[model samples]
Target chain A: MSGTAPEMGRRDGSFEREPARRVFASELRECRYQFKDGEDEKSPTFVLLPTGERSNRIFIVGTLTEKTRQGEQNIFYRGRVIDPTGTFFIMAGSYQPEAMQQLAKIETPAFVAVIGKPNLYQKPDGSYLASVRVEAITVVDKDTRDLWVLDTAAHTLDRVDALATSTSPDIVKAKEQYPSVDPAVYRKMAYDALAQIKM
Target chain B: MDYSEVTERISRKFSKSGKEIDRQKVEGKLRRLIDEFGVQPSEAERSVSNELAKEFNIPAAGSSGGTGAGAGGATEQKAIAQAQPGDWVTLEGKVVSLAAPASPAIAQSGIIADESGGIRFVVWAKSNALKMKEGAWYRIESAVVDEYKNIPNLKVHSGTTITEIEKTDPLIPEPSPIRDLRPGIGSVRAKVIQEWEVTHDRMLQSGLLGDETGTVKFVIWKEPGKEKLAVGTVYSVFYAQVDEYNERLSLNITTATIMQEEGDIVTATGGDVEIRGAIVHIAPGSGIIKRCPVPGCNRALSRQNYCPIHEIQPNFVYDLRIKGWLDDGEKTHNILLKRDVVEALTGINLDQAKEIAENNPLGMDEVFLQMRDKVLGRYVACKGREIENRLLVNTCERMHFESGEHAKLLNRAGGAP
Candidate 1:
């Protein structure tokens, strides 16, 4: 604190980059924690994804339910993917031409999967606005979309169980990051997603 | 043993021809000298005789000022800081630092000190000196304390006697803060903030360590079956070989070195650190360099073209490297990206780097330029050890997001960039 030297908190760079995540648009918007040191560090914006798991990266596979342009020049393309429970927004800029061109060919209401990074912004009211900066977007079959739902629901349930019961320090840390954690809505989402197959 | 005999002796001494002897005064003086003064009996005999000689008008036999002893006669204790120039002094302390012989005449040059302070000392080869060990206290007698450029040092020659003393260790300085660390501290302690695999003559775990004052890159020499230092642990490291690279100090952890995890023993954790900054400049030694093709000796072969192990006739392999400076609004860290990591960042494989070098007249300089175009003025997130000012890059990537992305976005877990 006396300008002694660099502090260790600023240089903890290796944490939370090990796995990408799968989350929902509503949960992304609801979550609010952004940890960064400076421009040189990839500050992991901590969030509780829809599957009730806490992570920094998220992977989504849903239906290409809607597509629209926000900017007047049409340089920015924003699309909505519908998973069983919630919508995941996929944004592709002019820089991501391959993903943009791929999205243009797909018709509305088709099953599509997207891998992207979560962009988090803290609102003035202390809530966070969340979106995904799409790295790759692909059209998949109905079966592929269903399989994703099953896998994602299982992951979300496993996380929910861990959060509700486990006292491991890492889970404790995740809980601290998102203080008012509620996993019941995601548990319900998981149950509702499974009912469509009705096995 | 007999008070009557002692009284008779004092009375006899007082019975000189011209002196008026007061028997009471003679016994009274002897009583105070023996009882009150706590003088040794043999020494008290001499004092009483002298006292009687002075009192009864006989001249004393010896001068009373106790200045008879000199160096080597009776041991003289002096702090290293108190030793004056041209004084034959006795120094009782431990060796703090020792320099191996640079020439034939000087056997060793080192630091010696006691609780007071320290001074440089030289042991001459012809002094037929005993091998002085570090961290051991010894009493050095009859040594000439000399001054050079106003700095004092003990110059020991053949006449000096060095005897190992029976006592606790002389206090050695604690591992200095990272910022205060300079060349010549034989050992130190710091938290292992970053640890990763590196090549010396073989594959080993090396990374940056630091205290509040500063940081240094340390390499643990690979021992086939030994445990390695874990990240996030603090250790008191001994005899790490010191070196200077590009004016910044570095250390090598050898097999004989001792490292104990002193988790709470140290004041600073050399806390969680990283360089979040934009590339401001590209350092030299970037681009392609020839590495030794020898299985374990992957050291960068110097331009004179020799590997320390394989010498003269050597096989070479191509490796890509990147060195640059990153300014994180506050501090600037020198970063090095080696081989595959460099390829991942620059998008130029080793072959491509070589081809680009050969095609251009500037050769390696052109390759440096291309890398500069990709990196300079751009933000980067580098994970690695920050020793001295250099960031030994383990995993690094462009920092385009205002907030951190999923770890998978940059590929692989990060280290000191």
Candidate 2:
């Protein structure tokens, strides 16, 4: 909307647009660093990338490998999206009604992009599990999916590159959170995803 | 919604501008804009509204957005293409890329894109409100915009609010071109011209690759003999890690790096080492150059012939340099011959160069031309390293290809260890 000089978007609205981060499905599930946003806030949880980066909002692209309606609300649209390396669990709620509708209309094995927040749950064994809170999901083309793969691969490599000397707080947290993650696996996932793309 | 439904929405928006336009006419305008002007339906709607407002002498609700640095209402959507530093902004974009911060104290950063373009934004670590999810459209508001390295950047601070909304049309960015290749995982098309033995301790295979843009040195670290880039073959290098060593960008063809041969590349797009070419072009400062007059700052005086630190005329000094191209029968390399190299090749020292400069009315121009004549047309094999795409010859000897010195020339390609 061209109106005046280039400036930050008008701050008139009460809502803010979140910046989405790209992460591989394999790395996302392994991430165990979950913390509250701003200490007192609840609802949206933060997951630290194994390489020490943190993000509440992440966008991922993959094939919608499976989907099902869970419980009474059918309200919970449970789905799994398979990337090059692993599959991500997506739970679409009433808040994501549009994404739910889109999910219902699209067939499985279709190229899909999902933008979601991280939701963490602790098991009885004390280990943590990370799944996605579907904020939005849409069927996309191969081109869009490949571009996503490229960006995600680049991001994953940045963390791997930084891991050698990263003693920063995020990296330290990541090391503590997912101590079992080889990081090599994530790098491989990124490369595999990129290889699938024609470019 | 169909075309008619979209047109009705356009008419309602226009009526708010206090302009009375027939609904049928507006629909006709939308149809023409879509069919003839090639405007998108949404864009045509906005165009029709603006046109009707202009016709009625009414102020357009959405005035043309200016591009200079300024502030605005946070709710206004600033397309990534229109975003600038200093704007209190709100907009929708897909998180396309993310970067690890140097310090966890600093906010995380990444590139956000829409159909307009992409931008880098930092979500303050302290904000902790949202670790933005990439690949989804968001409603970001109350964020401060700042310039990072001369480019406008968005900063999501404590007060910034992030709301994930329904996904919009996908925004797929163009892949990075060879010329735009920088340090990181870059995809490029290059030709392998030389390969070195694996390093003893690291087992890294180092070599050189060339593309039309320029030549780059590369190193690969993985299982030996799994991948071998043949000489003179062009290949698409993907996921290659680019790093800077000796202040030059080199690609690390590591375990993850992929290279598929396209064909035998005649371009000889390779590194600037072991160049065998003739001098076809000579730069202006090839002969009789001057150095800075300031003490302890002995930089060569630029074309302006002024010292950057002193901002004044530097004392003229005599130096001999042979600047020209070295064509390897396929590619031309910019080779610079320093004083010693010049003296060795042309049998002329700095004092002799000054004598020629003093006798000629054109001074350095006459000397530069004479130096070009002596070095031109002759092919020389030089062992050198490239600094910013220009070859700085450490050692050189004129080649005699037909004289059965093939082994000697090939040995030079190994470089002086």
Clashes per model (N, Cα, C within 3 A): 24, 44
Question: What is the C-alpha lDDT profile of model 1 across A1-199, one tens digit per residue?
Answer: 1011123222543221224454544556665555433465644455544333455445566788889866767677889887767777788887777567667766898777675667777669976677777755666555455545554555656666777788875577667776666777656655666555433
Off by over 4 Å in 2: A1-9, A12-16, A42-44, A125-127, B1-417
lDDT by residue (A22-110, candidate 2, tens digit) is 78887777776677657565444667777678777777778898999877845768889888768888887677775677677778888
Model 1 DockQ reads 0.02
Q: Specify the poorest-scoring 10-residue window by lDDT in model 1 chain A.
A: A1-10
**Tens digit of per-residue lDDT, candidate 1, span B247-305:** 66676555323556645434353533566655544555677887877765677777656
TM-score of chain A of 1: 0.76
The candidates' DockQ values read 0.02, 0.01
Docking tier of model 1: it is: incorrect
Say which candidate scores most in lDDT.
2
Q: Runs in model 1 with CA error above 4 Å? A: A1-199, B1-69, B72-76, B79-89, B94-102, B108-121, B128-137, B142-154, B158-285, B294-314, B325-334, B349-373, B383-389, B401-417
